[model samples]
Target: MPDARLVDSKASFASFSNVLDARLLRALADLGFARPTLVQSKAIPLALENRDILARARTGSGKTAAYCIPVVQKILNNTAASSSDSQSTRALILVPTRELSEQISAHLRGLVTYCDKEVTIANVSSGTTHHLQRTLLSDKPDIVVATPSKALALLQSKANTTLVIDEADLILSYGHDEDVRQIFSSGYLPKVYQSFLMSATMTDDVEQLKGLALRSPVILKLEEDEDEAANLTQYSVRCSEVDKFLLIYVILKLRLIKGKCIIFVNDVDRCYRLKLFLEQFSIKSCVLNSELPLNSRYHVVQEFNKGVYEYIIASDESIKKGEQDVESEEEDAAETKDDNCDQSKSRKRKHRHKGEGDKEYGVTRGVDFVDVSCVVNFDLPPSSRSYTHRVGRTARAGRSGMSLSFVVPEKEWGKNKVVGCVESTKKDEKISARIEAEQAARGSKIKEYKFDMKQVEAFRYRMEDALRAVTRSAVREARIKELKTEILNSDKLKAHFEDNPLDLEYLRHDKPLHPARVQSHMKHVPKYMLPKIAPVAGAEAPADSVAQDVGFVPFKKGGDRGRGRGRGRGRGGKKKSDPLKKFGR
Candidate 1:
């Protein structure tokens, strides 16, 4: 059974004076936290009694404070009772990202400001000087907030009494489950200590992690209020691949976005590409990707919060890699290098692509941006969970916001179909099946998530109307010419265009319009234009239209089709050919 100090559902922060330390209560008051949030009220008391907690709450629900307050209270009480070394670590907080670790550290410092006892706190993570981390850990602080991998490396000497994993879902998603297990089984932590796992979304993976980490834990699942979703306006726009940038430009030009906005892309390359495209239109923006140095990433975030840039584009790439993996790769490369100088240079070229691997960290879960008014999904996220996290950046703390996603129709680049598979050969059957199964599972989960379908449809219609209006507006022609002149005159874009002229082809020619398209476009045309314009006659067809015709051709399956002709043809045939056998050979 949990401790009696656990607060009731209706209890406020002031109501917990009997259970909470006086100094902690004073600090909370100074921070202007009069009432406890649902998670904080329920989880704090149980945590103070050394109870394990598995909590599921929405983002921006004060979950950080829920865990931080109890941990601090426990540490203060323990230090007061015993005259132990003030620098010894008692609590360890593990987060998925360095940004989150910094945020938690800052919040902990705020909570400890009013305490009479000197409570020391330190943040250890990658991208910081190794010597600095060593110095910080040498004189162990009362609380240490760190990424899982970094914590495991620096925590060999301390036996912490409590462990808190914030954004537990993200830890599993980044394949850091093993790193987490290593921390628990590292023989450094106490066998019996309080553990807390908090997440915005709960899934089977989180359940599995709970089984592995907790014992007799109290589960607190706070249902998100309908008012939270009511405050957010979620919608999506359907556009072709080539027109996506144009659509975004139109939206921004029309002043559809309000206040500060965040644009999320699926990978780093697209993140930069979108930034450059926006720059061509004289739209100033900054980018947040893993390739930037840690200091630069921090500066970008700081500047973004200060309103230095209206749009900050971020990538969803996982940038944390194990130190062991990095060391082993370097050793193997050194061992395989030939004595010849040219051979060494050739080897370097061969491994050039590997340099793109996740070598630096980027923004992820638990980082908070203040007063964000909108979140734009330049690329659709691969899962519903990602979608939730991206949109959760806005409408925080009961404020109203909006989220817009661009949905592009899938297309084929060549003869092969764009069905998720690289090839349509029989050898890829298993791989294709696995891909389809995963996609189907994600699709089912998204449907069950229950977003507002009516609102989404209405938003789509509105976007269509906006697109037509922008396309037919008299200012569009002048705007396009002005944009072209700017792009050609700007030194940065001019050089880029010289190197990659194909990127500007879309702007060079006006796309031909079909009769149906013209009719739809006419709906948005001004009344003055309607009187001057007339539909094209059939005789006006260009003589070269027939020459431009390119009929569709069906994709032919690769490899031998007859039975016994291929290696994996018949039931008695040789073992099925491995799809990756070519790379090995």
Candidate 2:
């Protein structure tokens, strides 16, 4: 159950109509938001009163509107108080990703559409040019939704009266803690301003941010509906590394995947690789990663929503470009270069600097895809929290969804030693431990669902048959050619390679070459009909051996046929006892 104080059964947007301005109510009506979600009902009123709020709600439980409504209303109130000529940015909303920033900005724009006062809003993120953002900021929009790095950059010149950190848990996860800290501690903004921290999970990192950023905040914890869990059918498949993709192909071929699906990989390279592999099967799909331009990403999402594509392979790469650390070697080289040479190189670099698409902020968090019926974990998420977020992509807004995960069995090292497939390395082990601890701390559990072995075998067979249609050699060659062309054509890659020719050579030399598939001789043979290895001549026969009774000569031991030691007899003629005899006694 949710906190009793936060769950008002009679709570509606109209109930707060007296408190809210007429324009906002009209916007809500136009948007068809009849009732306030649990978080909205509780957090909205408290936020309207200008109280700092730390809130936890389910992923699709209207947390955005909960904070956005208050921030909009507050900005409008401040606007009404001041002169119409005054247009200072009053509210700042910081989200984790560009997709989320745009989403929030769009929603806020819709909400303030019918407002009497002209409430201008703008969104600033890494995808677009800083010049355009600066131009937009020069207008002094009443509210600005932005990513942390870009927001921090903008806040240096433009200060806000209110701050909202949506998906606060992701702020730390995406390594924006420092940017966030700078905004709060940097005297550029007001010493005292209203703040709101909201997320689906109340992580320790979020709590720490609350202590550092917010002044005495009101905590609102909303429970997830158990029925929502029931709405999603979770399942796991035990598979090998190679078989995972095969299984995916089989699932797709069989039409087992329902509606719009997202295949989530841990890194960008894997996402691209999987997309290419799916293409070999003639399965058309789009990719959503940081590598694509923001507009392209926006377009991909729109197309996906319109059923233009059945599947979109996404990656969990969330490191922003401004946050990337420059290599010391590059710095040293730059400092040692001649003035004229440096100027020439600078001009070349300026020419090469096309845009910010070179940055690798892959799609992990803050992406909401509509009608996502299923989420497939092409690779297992590093942590339980990641798993939660990935699955939360589906089963959103009270809709039923499904999540499927692939778990590889631990490999045996020796008779007694076993190693995990995913967490095989030390760093992976540490990360897995941290994820487990985080999940335990938050009381999150991953429910396991059983799958039938016959169905699995059938799928495997179908996958193997599908693989035969596309040769690994051909796919590898095609992929290599495509990559080489991409590298040669890309200004960023060409510039990077020019800086380090050895790296370019390495890329050419290390072009992906998948091993040729070998046909197994025993693949189609029945297990019972397979020939067994012949017994050694010196080995003792079985106790019920038909060969021994048919006058088969036994091998001599130590070249002494008459005085040989019998089976199970030691040199000292002692009989061995069971090791568990003591326990039995």
Candidate 3:
């Protein structure tokens, strides 16, 4: 490893010419990347020099390209210098989630498009058969991307290999500490090799990984520039439990928020509940959660980026549960027998079904969501860290974005038990306070946004009717139905879609999952029922006489001409004519 050094600040590279190969520079241009990001500009030069690096940069700061360019450049350089014809795995990239492994592999493929004949990569984190993975590894691909568990089988000493751990902080949180220990202690790492530990935050777990994986490494902590910081605007709305649903319905149905938006919830059940609720209004949205198959999850993200769906209801359930597990253990240690019993039941209810919600899946940390215009936190996260990552999905790559969070006031937490979440009821206020403090510490603020309830009141009864239909049983049925549909459409028709591109459009994820009663009239907003536009300030005020003369009619007509029991026919009890029903006559 190179001697340790600490650098505070530096200018970004003007271009990718000096540090990157011509082929890589061409690929960058083709991919529409104008210049190197701050982290990329600084780390690429040092990494090319074979220096170990511990770098911290926020999400969407181009950290993937920062390390990938150097790795590819070094591989190209090594192949040119060596005379051996035998191919071998020279670089190993470890990520926390399967989604991240796939994302990195895709990016690497893009970077190596012009040089695919010479460079090859494999992603072992993909849920393929073990036999197939072993076969792929037996061929000795140039680069291997995997989760720590997947890399366990491939941890053997190889000469001049490079080790890169992306999202190092999340690796341990995903419960891979033992796998990490085995890799580091197995004595399989090459004596002379470059190492990179990349993370978004400097957590204790990250420090622990650094000690095991790096020696005398240079530390680079890059802060977001002024432009980057100004791109994101954050707001929080205080509302009751039912109001959360009402506000989201109004915001989405009325197009108050535009462009692709990600609505985040705290658990798996909540994902389907919100999805089913939105479906009542004929608003289509896809669901992305850990319970779904890996292929389906990846495909959903792909479709979202391509604009096949405008809204996605996602769950950070696994990540939140991971944090909750540790906290619950601490509470159990200090609490009494009654408290322990209650927690035991809660655990059972949370984990009723295995191989589903209880996995290492995470949407907040590593998955890439492109061009998100807004993030709606249907349920406030359990911690400030979770909140940060949830909101980080938007305002990426210098594009403007907005984040709107629904905070349940303490007094209104459980007032409406039907739509209330236990976790949110117990911890929302505290978590919201911490989030505000954390943001303020970082020179940002989360302002309170108040929606005019009187104006939104017209939609409340409709929201109630919609909410009534989304019972627990209905949510469960929808969840199972969607899973079965995804397996059929995504897995069974995977080959067909590949061969026929146009057919992929018919494979929609946002199709309505209507196990509950769906009312056709609820689909459209009536003109008169629409919220009236507020009068602009400084405009001419209507005279008192004119204001008094105005009637309840929305249109300019004789108001009471059509409002009579007789209907201008007679005061006799006669059957009203139905022209459509008597069309045959």
Clashes of 1: 0
Q: Which pairs of residues have clashing backbones in candidate 2?
A: 317-362
- What is the per-residue lDDT of model 2 for residues 1-585, given as tens digits with 9 covering 90 to 100? 112344344667776765677899999999878888778888877877778999988777788888888888877777777766756888888887777887788888889988735688888873557898899999888888887888878775445778888888877656577887887677767877888998888777798889876888899989865654444555555556656766676566434555689988754445555655555555667666555556556656756776767888886643222211123225436755643443465446435643434342535556668867778887766555666777888766666666777765444211111111222111222333444455445554333433333434544553454455345345445445544444443443325755874553233211223332324441232333222223436876456533222110111112222221111222243532211111110
Best-to-worst TM-score order: 3, 2, 1
By lDDT, highest first, what's the ranking?
A: 3, 2, 1
Better of 2 and 3 by TM-score: 3
Evaluated at residue 403, the lDDT of candidate 2 is 71
- Among all windows of 10 consecutive residues in model 2, the one with the lowest summed lDDT is 576-585
Per-residue lDDT of candidate 3, residues 45-137 (tens digit)? 788778899999988888999899889988888888889998888999989888899899999999998887778999988867888888888
What's each prediction's TM-score?
0.65, 0.69, 0.87
In TM-score terms, candidate 3 sits at 0.87
**Candidate number with greatest lDDT:** 3
lDDT of 1 by residue, 99-182 (tens): 677678878988998873567888886455788898988877888898887887787654688888888887755656777888
Q: What is the lDDT of residue 407 in candidate 1?
A: 59
Q: Per the 3 Å backbone cut-off, how many clashing residue pairs does candidate 2 have?
A: 1
